[model samples]
Target chain A: MEDEPSSRPAGRPRDPGVAARVLTAVQDLLITNGYAGTTIAAVAQAAGTGKAAVYRRWSGKADLVVAAVLALNAPVSVPDTGSLRDDLVECAMHYARGDERATRVLASLLSEIGHDPQLFDAANRAIGRPPVAALVAVIEQWVRRGAISADVPTELIAGIIPTAAFGSVTLRQRTLDTQTISDLVDHVLLPALTGAHGSSTQLL
Target chain B: MEDEPSSRPAGRPRDPGVAARVLTAVQDLLITNGYAGTTIAAVAQAAGTGKAAVYRRWSGKADLVVAAVLALNAPVSVPDTGSLRDDLVECAMHYARGDERATRVLASLLSEIGHDPQLFDAANRAIGRPPVAALVAVIEQWVRRGAISADVPTELIAGIIPTAAFGSVTLRQRTLDTQTISDLVDHVLLPALTGAHGSSTQLL
Candidate 1:
């Protein structure tokens, strides 16, 4: 572990475990009390750390909540299974099986997003972009192998999997099952990407 | 106009326009302040109406907000286009082009849904169920005509259009355009429903 900065107050060094503990506390508070109710002081107290310690890591509630949610989701390690279909299904499932706590936190955060720009940006940066990035990388590999049509926009290609899963959760409050995930890949995504479904004129 | 009840406090009869005025105010508050910021007092003040007038119209914020969102969306009269794809496209477009105020209100309300059961239920009752009902009815008609396979679950079939639009807005903060909407209907919905373009095993 690195030593405390010379500017640090004369005391025992900060616990390396405090960051994880504080993030856990932040997640619990965000889920239980919501954006308005969660406070730095409350999180600090729950984590058994000082408010300054929490501040040292995250600038404010929006920043803290973003980090907390990211931790809850962990990172989706993109799988390279050679087949674009397999890669896409595995990528989609990462979001389909989001943990309950993360779902609750996100559900609770949705209403606040329109009103708070910072929180929205934080969420998109931490949660939204990573999956898209992973998907894009996978699609690039597929394009290299002449698997997927090169003409298909990577953004649109990347969008179908997560968006399908997202649509299920948003409208039905249900997760994408194994069947739905595969269907989205084979019937919807693969056809769209391969230019084998409907007329190309239909696409954006 | 119906007379006030005999036990009514004698005063000028309730304004014929109060309901519309109050609902408009509720919309403004919901769009501007979000659910937490919008209060009965603020709504009454914005409407230039008395607290009692607002309360008489809506039981609380949840009721008021639901009514406002519903009014903004307006009821979609599912078109009898004789084609399920056309009907689905038309219905999905109704939500895709939601006015700025309605979009803002919905984005704000999304985060609050999990914590407030009353709001969640009210939102579902007014803003959520209508589209589903309309979609189900359309699918039923299609089923009767042998336009779509009977094997496809009505709920899954109904979910695609709106959920696709919803996912677009949620993750990307983008609305579904005419082209994307048409593509989703033609490429995703039609293929899934008709069991064409690929194997039928992929459907929900």
Candidate 2:
């Protein structure tokens, strides 16, 4: 790792494991105490690091919480299964099967996030944009192949699965099951993308 | 007003005005202090009433807040405009233009609601069910008219606009504008319902 010569205090080299420990501490504190309750001092204490070490990595609580939450949701690989339906289904399942602790932390953060603009922006950047980007990439491939229309609002269409998954956890207190994911892809995403309903018998 | 004869303590009949004041106070405190911060005693003080008055009406904080939120979102009348498109658009806009205070309260409650089973159930009944019920009613009307397939997951189709509107306010920090709502209806909702794309030119 490159040293931040200017920012680093002239001393012995930093502990290589501090960052991981601090991040893990942040998640634990967040899940237990929530956004308002989780403090840098508490995180540092839990991580067995100094407050200065935590601050050196992240600016403050918002930054730390956002980083912790982002880490909790490890990015799903964008599937290139040659079928948009399959890709979307895989994407939905990935979100539906997200870590329970992450869901709890996010649920706790939702309130604080609304009140704090900095936290909201940090969350939107760290948590919100990635899946949409992945979905957009998948949809664009179909558009290029002429299998889907060029005029599809790729961004809006891309938001459906992620938004649904979010609502499921944060509001409904459940994850979307496999059958529900398939139904969403075939009925909502597929129909919206292809302009054709899936399984006419299912529709009838 | 029908008195809760069993629950109400023997005293002068309950004041009709106290319920309204308590509810209004609950909204104000929720918006200002968030779920964890707002207490029943605080709400009583803000409303210039006794805690017993607040308790007599609702069991606790969750009930009071849920009632207040429900009151804030005055039920949208289900439109039967003789056109499914018009009806759906009307429903979407109704949610898009929801009370800002209600949105803030909800954003605050989201975290706490996940942890509290009673709050979750009360919120689902008070806040969540009404709009979905309204949308389901409208879609069922169309289904009866044979304009849309009977087998359409009316419940899922009904959920889209409201979910989008909720995500817009809670996550995106803005209401869905007319153009975005229209595009959602034309591109997503309508297609999913009718199995046909809207506007050939728009599709291209």
Candidate number of the best DockQ: 2
Deviation from native of the Cα of residue B14 in model 2, angstroms:
3.3
Clashing residue pair totals per candidate (backbone < 3 A): 4, 0
Query: Best-fitting candidate, measured by lDDT?
Result: 2
Per-model DockQ:
0.29, 0.61
lDDT of 2: 0.75
Candidate 2 recovers a fraction of native contacts equal to: 0.68
Restricted to chain B, the TM-score per model reads 0.78, 0.82
**Interface C-alpha RMSD per candidate, 1 decimal:** 4.3, 1.5
lDDT of 2 by residue, B1-204 (tens): 232344666785777877888888888888778777899888888888788767767888767777887776556589998878888877767666645566666766776776777767766666677778888888889999998999788888788777777777776567777777778888898899998756523421
Local error of candidate 2 at A110, Å?
Answer: 1.9
